[model samples]
Target: MGDLVLHLDNINKSFGGLSALSDVNLHVEEGTTHAIIGPNGAGKSTLLNVCIGRLKPDTGKVTFAGEVLTGRQPHEIAQLGVARVFQTPEIFQEMTLLENVMIPALSHRDGAFRLNATELLSKQGEVREEAEHILEDVGLKDMMMVEAASLSRGDKRRLELGMCLILRPRLLLLDEPTAGMARHDTNQTIELLKKIKSRGMTKVIIEHDMHVVFSLADKVSVLARGQIIAGGDPQSVREDPKVKEAYLGGTT
Candidate 1:
C-alpha cells in the first residue's frame, strides 16, 4: 500500500428528511483497489457523486492526490487526475469506437473543445496513435471503427473504460463496472481490471458482486444506511458478524 490517494472526512448528505450519508469517512490507499459494498440504499452512488463533483455533500470534504475536490467542477476534477466510469456506459452512441476514444485523447492534449483546424492538424497524428493504443489495451482494436451504438452492452462498457484509460488518470472511480453483463463478459471485465491493477492504478469500486470485489479489492468497506459497518481485508470483512447480519446474509 502507498499513501492515501483519496480521502473523505466527516461527509454528510440528505434528501428532504432522509439522510443519504452521515459522517462518512473513507480512505483509499494509492495503487490499490478499494471496494465499497452495501445494500441498495447504502449511499454508494451518493458517495461517488461527491467524489467526482457530480453532487456536493451538504457537509464534508473530499480530497484527491493531496488536493481538495469538494467544490471542483466535474471537468476540474478530471484535470486533477480523477476519472469516473458510471454504472451505465457513457459513450457517443453515434460515433465510431475509435472516434469516441480519440476524442478524449485529443481533449487531454488540448482543451475539451479545440476547433482550430491548424492546431488540430498539427497534433492529430499523436492523438490518433494514443487513442489506438488505448483501444488495443481495452481489447477493442478489432472493432475500432465500429459504431458504438452497434456494440453489445459488454463491449460498450469496455469502450467507456477505454475512454477513461486514455486520460491515464491516477484515481478511477468505477460504479458497477460489470453490471448487466453475461458471465463470460463479466469474466472478461475481471481480467481487464486485473490488468489495470497490475499497472498500479488506484480504483474505488462500488459493486454488488462479491466475486468481483474479492477478485480485485485489496481492502473492503461495507456501508449500510449511510455509514460504514465494516472495514478490513476481503476475508476479514466478509467474516465480520455485523457485516453479515446487515448485508452479507451471514455467509462468506
Candidate 2:
C-alpha cells in the first residue's frame, strides 16, 4: 500500500536457451525493506542485475522513481539513485578504508571518475570528514587508515557497505549480504541494516540467511525456478507451504 518506488514488469531472461527468469513481476514500496529469497540457482540475483542495468531482460521494463531504466547503462541507473552491494565486497584492496568510502561520494558529486582522484580526494575536506563519519557509522573508523586488503572478511563487507552509504541512493539492493560471516558479524550487519531501515531508505535484499531476512525485511518474496511462488510479511512467507517446499525440500 505504500508508494511504489521500484517496479519490475513482465520480466523474462534467458541464456543459451536456459531460462533464468520468467515473467517476473515485483513491486517494491517506498521506504520498505523488500527481500528476495530462494534456494540456490533461483534467479534472485538475476532479478537484481536487471534492476541495476547489469543484465537486460529479453522482455520487460524496470521503472524506478518514475524513470525508465531498462535500456540505460549501469552508471546511468546509478545516477538515478540506485546502488547495489554485490555478494563479495568490492573495494580498492590497496586503498585505505576511508579512501574507499570517499571514492563513490566524490564520483557521484562530480558526475564521473576523476583522473586526479587522489589529489582531489585529499583536497575535499568536507568529503573526507563525511567519509570518516560514515566509516565510523559502519564501525570502521578505528581502522580507517588501514589498507582494505589487510582487513578481515567481515570488515571488508562493512567497508563496502560504507562505500554504498556514501552515495545516498534512494533505493539500495543487496545480494547475499551475509553470505559468509560469523554469527557475531552477521548479527552486527543485521543491526546496521536495521539502523538503515530506521532511516526509511528503501532496500531490496537477496539473502539466504533466514535470520537476516526476518530481522530486516518488511516484505518477503520467494523466488523458485525464476518465478515468484509466495510473497507477504516475513511470518506469512515463513509459514507458506510453497516456501517450505521449495526452500526446505518439503521437510517439516
Candidate 3:
C-alpha cells in the first residue's frame, strides 16, 4: 500500500441535536481511489465536507500529507493540494470553458485576484494552452471556446472536472460526480475518472453508483447512520452482509 495521504480519526459532527457523522474514521492511501457509499441522509456528504475543510467535526482530527488539517479554511485546504468537486457543477456561466480553467492557473501564477489587466491578457496564451491541455485530458478540447452554460450537462461536468484537474491537487474529493447524468454520460464520466486515476491521482469519491465504485475503487467504505459499517476491497465490500443490509438494501 502507498503512504497515507489522508487520515480521519474518530471524526464526529452534529448539527444542533441531530448527528450527521459519528466516530467516522477513514484512511486514503496515496495514489489510490477510495470510494465511500451510503444511502440517503447517511452523512456521506458531511464526511466529505469535513475532509475538504468545508465543515468542521465537533470531535476528531483530519490529517493530510502528515500535516494536521483541523480548523483550516476550505481555501487553505485547497492550497495544500486538496480539491473538491461538488455534486452540482459550479462553472462560471458567462465564461468560456477555457476561461474557467484559466482562472485557477492565473490565480496560481499571479496570486489570487491580484492580476493586472495587461498582465492578465499577456498571460492569456499560456493560460489558454494549459487550459486546453486539461480540457483535452477531460475530453473537452473541442468545447474550449464554448460558454460553460451552453455545454450539455455531461460536457459541463467535464469542464468542471477540467477546472479541478488544473489545480494539480494531491488529493481530489468528489461528491456524486456522476449524479443526474444519463447512463451514457455517467459512463463517459467514469472513463474520464479512470483516465485520471491511471495518471496516478489520489481520489476519494462519495457515490451511489455501484458500477462506478466497483470499477474504479481500490477500496470501499460503506456508511450507514453516521458510521462506517464495512470497509475493504471492492469485491468484499460488495459482498459484505452488513453493508448489504444497511446501505445496499440487500441487493447483494
TM-score against native, each model: 0.95, 0.95, 0.94
Per-residue lDDT over 1-252 for candidate 3, one digit per residue giving the tens place of the 0 to 100 score: 588879999999999989999999899999999999999889999998888888889999999998888998777787888888888887898998878998877765665456385554654787778878998898888877888898887787778888888988888889899888899989989988988887677899999889889888999998899999999999998788888888777443
Model 1 vs. true fold: TM: 0.95
Error of 1 at 14 (Å): 0.5
Query: Which residue segments of model 1 deviate by more than 4 Å?
Result: 111-115, 120-123, 250-252
Write out the backbone clash pairs for model 3: none
Assess each prediction's global lDDT (C-alpha) against the native: 0.90, 0.90, 0.86
Write down the RMSD of all candidates, one decimal each.
1.7, 1.8, 1.7
TM-score of 3: 0.94
Is candidate 1 or 3 superior in TM-score?
1
Displacement of the residue 171 alpha carbon in candidate 2, Å: 0.5
* Candidate that scores best on lDDT: 1
